[model samples]
Target: MSAEHTASAPAGPLWRLALGRSLGRSRKFLWFLLINILPLYVASDLLVTSGALAKISGFLEPVMSLWGLPPEAAAVLLAGMLVNLYAATAVAAPLALSWQQVSVLGLILGIAHSLIMEAVVVRQLTRRYHALTLLRIVLGLGAGWLLALVLC
Candidate 1:
């Protein structure tokens, strides 16, 4: 283990190595982003505006309310446009959110959403992982809701 650690550890920043590797595969990443991410953003925006999200939100409201999240969160829940879990935070932030609600949104989204293509990218990066994705969603839900209860 120590040998493995020594082999992987470098004298410089990890980001430099990661950036080098990513830049080496920049074309692949760019194409991946183009084919996957752009389409998802468009679709998510359309679906939410087209009333699909409203229907879904209506269904989720009762359950989500338990975590102090309002139904509107469902819109952002489907989209991963936020880097810092921005979508959910944007919705919840304007509201009279308690720390619990904020934490719940933070935790839940910190784990779930953008499942369609991001999960594919994650799977590709981690070698065909479906279970981790599911686990993340479950953990996000549980952890967020739990945080809400505790904090709020």
Candidate 2:
């Protein structure tokens, strides 16, 4: 109930940002954001805004460029892979990506989101977790490539 702890709904893409924000200003969402998203955003923000990621981004640019994304998208993609799509999205909102680029990112994450956790969940259900995980990643990238080629 305190002023400092209270956060307004987030702003950005309509459905993912606005609707989710409106529906998700609850305590649990706040806790999840603080715990799961904030640190990633903080580190990504520091690296991105401070220009510290330039060198790393240089190395990643080629890979991200395949998806018609900028090097900063690597952070967004990493956040999605290591954490969850929501976290990746939260991290990505400030990057000023175009609608088409966001769409490409969405296409990739939709197929391969939350690999670290989902892979474990998949492992619990099947013995082919590694293959499935690899397939998702490869398919995700391939899908992104196709989408980027089409969109751009």
The prediction achieving the highest lDDT against the true structure is: 2
Q: Which pairs in model 2 have colliding backbones?
A: none
Off by over 4 Å in 1: 1-59, 81-96
At residue 65, what lDDT does model 2 achieve? Answer: 83
lDDT of 2: 0.83
Span of ten consecutive residues with least summed lDDT in model 1: 80-89
**lDDT per residue as tens, model 1, 1-152:** 46554337685777787777679799886876677656655665665567665576787888678777767565555543233343444434334556666567767887776666577688777865688778878898888777877876
Choose the strongest candidate by TM-score. 2
- Model 2 C-alpha lDDT per residue in residues 1-152, reported as the tens digit of each score: 66444444545554665456577678687798799777877777777787777666778888788888988888888888877898888778777789989999999999998997898889989999999999999999899999999998
Clashing pairs in 1: none
Give the Cα error of residue 88 in candidate 1, in Å. 4.0
Q: Please provide TM-scores, in order, for all candidate models, with all chains considered together.
A: 0.51, 0.74
